[model samples]
Target: GPRSESGALDAQPWSAAAVAEATSAGRPVLVNLTADWCVTCKINERAALSSPRVAQAVKQANAVYLVGDWTRRDDAITRELQAHGRSGVPLYLVYRPGRAEPDILPQLLTEGVVIDALKP
Candidate 1:
């Protein structure tokens, strides 16, 4: 796991505890599945994530930020991707707590889109 500026993507050993807890507490989990080698990933960093709206939502929603770093070759991540039916970077998955399905955000996100996800 790599270090994230926010809690969700913070340094980790890939513990689902946070996600489970959030879901248990009636909150959705927004996950940023990104890769260092991806240029679009970098763009997302500057465009969507860096926006004030995004930062505010991070704190307002107290959403757990989880980051899947595809910069390297990790078997677990690879397996997770395969399970999710994808074999690439920039996969965004938002799991609404208690819902049977998760809302998969697009490969390219903006401040408005991210904020909308925070809404119930």
Candidate 2:
């Protein structure tokens, strides 16, 4: 995954094991599953994830930000999408520490919604 120039998130490369490790260590994780050609994904990135409030909320929560790029049909990303019952791009998931499941965000994002999702 490529890092964004915006200072809001330190986007890391996505991997199943990395997610497991972060959650196991009691850290909240935010996974943004997006693609180069996904209009919705681009919209969310600009309208919500890039918002100062939402960015600050994520930073304040000490969340691990991971971005999975499905622009090239990666198998791991495909498996993850299927596991989440999704077959397309622009999926958002928040994995809270000690939680068995992640909170799924809508394809259309808002600062308030993203801030709420990052809440401990």
Candidate 3:
């Protein structure tokens, strides 16, 4: 697992294969699909995802944090967005162990929101 300079969990590049592997192994997974130019994404990152409480919750849950960058054209990311009936960035998804479908989180977030989502 990667750690940010602030010691929070650093998100890895998103990949369908990695997501599948984590889920199959019964690990919790958090996927953040964002773009460099998305203001809302940046806000959410600072307000929630970057919080120490969220980081601790993730670490306690042993969840993998994966980020999909949509600043550039990415066919895989586009397909993933389409799969969830979304056509843009700022998509947040939480995959719990043994779940077939992920829980889609709101575009806006708070530290409590992320911490609650990671709860078993």
Candidate 4:
């Protein structure tokens, strides 16, 4: 949950509506579907999303970063997971500018993976 000029992974809470708005405006958007108890999510955050290189990439891309916490049973989050054909946490999705669909990332992440996703 670090704060910086770059789009930090935990900088803001997730909002499905905001994702739609930003994408509609032609901006890249990153969404992390995490849970408090999910070990993979934490690992990905520390290894990739929180890395300096990835953060810079996000800033350079002018992307909107959002984190969805599913600590407890939340209907909206459940639906979102279902929509993506997922049944668990640590889902990573990138909605690039002008794209109708988001690019789904691996459960495990890397700095290069995130940086590449921010490419113009």
Q: Indicate which candidate wins on lDDT.
A: 3
Which tens-of-lDDT digit does each residue in 6-113 have in candidate 1?
Answer: 323232233356567778888677777777788987788678876777767766776666676778867767776776888887777777778857788778889888
In candidate 3, which residue ranges exceed 4 Å CA deviation?
A: 1-7
Q: Record all residue pairs in model 3 with backbone atoms less than 3 Å apart, i.e. clashing.
A: none
Writing each residue's lDDT as its tens digit, candidate 2 over 53-90 gives 87788889988888888999899999999999999888
| Alpha carbon deviation, residue 58, candidate 4 (Å) | 0.3
Segments of candidate 1 deviating more than 4 angstroms = 1-17
TM-score of 4: 0.89
- The residue pairs found clashing in candidate 4 are none
Better of 1 and 2 by TM-score: 2
Cα-based TM-score, every candidate: 0.80, 0.93, 0.92, 0.89
lDDT of 4 at 100: 73
How do the residues 1-120 of candidate 4 rate in per-residue lDDT, one tens digit apiece? 335312344467777898998888888998988887999888888778878788788888988898888889577888988899999898889997677779999888999988998898
**lDDT of candidate 3 over 1-120, digit per residue (tens):** 334412466678898988999888988999999887989988888778888888899999999999888899589999999999999988999998788899999989988888899999
Scored against the true structure, residue 115 in model 2 reaches a CA lDDT of 91
lDDT of 2 at 46: 84
lDDT of each: 0.70, 0.85, 0.86, 0.82
Worst 10 residues of 1 by lDDT: 6-15
